[model samples]
Target: MSDIPPLRPLLIERPEDEGAETPATVPPVPDLDIAVPPPRLSRARNSALTRFAMWVFGALFSFVLSVAAWDFVTSLLARDSLLGWIAMVLVGLAIVTAVALAAREMAGFARMGRIDSLRTNAIEAALKADVKAARGVVSGLGALYSARPELAEAQVRLTARGAEMFDADGILGLAEQELLGPLDQAARREVEAAARQVATVTALVPLALADVATALYSNLRMIRRIAAIYGGRSGTLGSLRLMRGVFAHLAATGALAVGDDMIHSVAGGSVLSRISRRFGEGVVNGALTARVGVAAIDVCRPLPFRTLPRPKTSNLVSRALAGLFADADRNEKVK
Candidate 1:
């Protein structure tokens, strides 16, 4: 106190700092007055581009072929020369072939579209529990299930019952149980067999090319089998459409990833691994094929279960893998 002066609070405010405004702590404005728009219902548009391209190609090919045939026939009749005759014959043959091919493709597209529409209708009806709509669609699908007399009869009976039923759930459940249950069982068996075959091939075949060829052949066969089960017995064009639909469903539903993971897990290698042991690789391939088959069934089925739950993917994969490994063990024992 004696030696040093008592320090006063320093005046440190700069002129530039004077009157500086601070951000206000504003409370969030209540949004109670703002109305949220209802979510729009969007329709799934699967494979629209592919379908359009197919239609365009078919139309253009048919048009070009018709023009060529007309010109060739005109030349043949007007010129009466050997060259003209030969050209006419060749063009006629080509025209016939092209027309036939185009007709088949168009027919396939029509059939596939009809089936898809029918399926969509059935599912929506089932979900809504609309007994009348379900009955109508089921009855309309009689042509598809004609191959199975028992199933066809069941469909008729179910439709009649559905007409009288008040509960949509009961009607849908009954329809699925009586009509789709048998088909599902048969399809499952087919898929399991195919999976086993694929797995065995992957495990035993040393050559990558052979393995690929075998897998492709098995997958094609499996697709055909699943389509047949759904009463979609397709010709060449029909088969192609069915295969496309199956793949589209797999990709859309993320079943492709499940299949890939299963293959990797079972085979102990990636799906494209060339140096993997044939036996283990084959087993994995078979399991993957089986998953695809099951997914195809799900996609192709015309009915949905409102009361009954469908089998889960996990259950299917587990069963398929177990069956494959059990078969391997049995084979080893036999050896």
Candidate 2:
């Protein structure tokens, strides 16, 4: 306080020597660039319209083809001539073949669609713990359960139990364990067997084309078998739909990447090394087949896994690859 001439009261005023700077305050502008998603109904409507268009086009094309065929037959022969009679006979056979094929395809489509609808209904019923709906869905699966009498009996018992139980979870759990469990096991085994078959074909068939054909045949057979296990028993069209569903599930679960990696790990070597190439291709194809099989199980399961954990893709790939390598090693040692 005694310092020379007590320090003048600390001046706190802005210095006049320099211009004062002020921060520019910006008013918040409303965001005009934000994107709003379209309504879901619009998208659904578009999809339905597209499907309708496709159906219309298909019908029109078939009609045109039938008319063209008739015209060609008429131009090729007089109606009274022997050649004309032969042509008519041939045309009749062709028509019968076409009709039979169309009927088969249509039936398959209907059956596959029905199975999908039934599964959805069953899942919903189980979630809601609705005894009547559950019973209805189970009864709808009679054709499927007929193939396995034990499963049919289990369904009957479950229906009776559902009537007694109040908890949705309990009823669903029992149903899953009693009814779906065997089908799951069977599907898993089918996939494993198909993988092994693919591996065997890949290893034994020297020709690439032959290997490709056999692999395709094996996969188709596997799909059919899986469909049958689920009580679908799809024909060619139904099988195609089943395969499509499987692929969709694989994509949804990100299993496709795992499957691809496994295949690449096994098949990345040069083709010039015949023995190695064959083994690698076989392992790769087998892994792919296994992935497809797993997808089928996921798609065909009547209910979503609430208590049970879904199978991990990595685990599946690991097991498939391990089995493949072990088999290869054993075979080599034997040789």
Candidate 3:
């Protein structure tokens, strides 16, 4: 058998094999045609609504004023008959105005209250810091002075009287007056020692506390400074005097406390005489107590509820009237 004989079909050409478009193909995408409203109409509508609301308000306001004016004119023409009515209306308006003014003033006063509290807090903080520094200084001075109190007392007395005790001319002159001759070698050494002690003590103490003490020496000083700030200067002189007396009493008490603290500190520390020699008994007694008192006094000073004297009601009324008159006078001058 011959296996070479197989029948093959003829080659056919397909038009779809070429990259040509067929008759059944759909068309490409068409351009979009959207209809948008004009923005000018929306803006115009908003403006028209706003104008209508404003016009309505203006018309209402004008109508109210016109009615009030008409009534006012009618009452004036009927003067004798409507006098009471006009007065009543006037009083009503005055009352309303007064109430509104009072409300506004009350709001302002409330704000002032907050500011006052803030100022008080600031003053308190500053005072505390000052007191702490002063306590350390005074305590150190107390220790130095305690070592030789006789000399310290003399110097303190001189300082109180505002004498120039520390200066070379003052010291030499005073020493000559007290001793009545040139200092012998031993006497000179003793005077030198006392002078040195005084200097040391003064150096240790704060000048600021001294400044405060000098500023507040009398009732007059206290009243002037305090009353000015608080707006109650009418009875300032009496207030100042009372405050000065109180301070003096307190200072005496403080001195006693200082002595007590010194005695306690010395006694409590050690049973041995050697221990007592270094830190005396008075040291502990006032050491903590005096500082505590100072802290308490500082805290009380700036409080709103102080027990200061008040002016009498009659006086207060007179003062108020005077203030009004003064204001009227000033207004007249300005005009």
**Cα lDDT of model 1 overall?**
0.65
Greater TM-score among 1 and 2 belongs to 2
- CA RMSD of all predictions: 12.9, 11.8, 38.1
lDDT of 3 by residue, 1-335 (tens): 88998889989886665556677664653322111110110011348778999899989996996678667756775776577567657757866896777675554344333323433443343345444333333233233234453446544543343233333333323322222121122222222232223222222345545422332332233233332232222232334333443344344434223333233232332332333232231222122222222222221222211122211212222222333334433554576
Task: State the RMSD for candidate 1.
Answer: 12.9
* Range of the 10 consecutive residues with the lowest summed lDDT in candidate 3: 34-43
Residue 268 alpha-carbon offset, candidate 2, angstroms: 19
* Candidate 3 runs further than 4 Å off: 1-246, 249-262, 265-267, 275-278, 281-300, 304-335
Per-residue lDDT for 220 in model 1? 85
Off by over 4 Å in 1: 1-94, 235-238, 258-276, 307-324, 330-335
Local distance difference test, candidate 3: 0.35
Say what the RMSD of model 2 is: 11.8
Q: Where does candidate 2 have its weakest 10-residue lDDT segment?
A: 34-43
TM-score on alpha carbons, each prediction: 0.65, 0.67, 0.16
Ranking, TM-score, top scorer first: 2, 1, 3
Q: Against the correct fold, how does model 2 do in TM-score?
A: 0.67
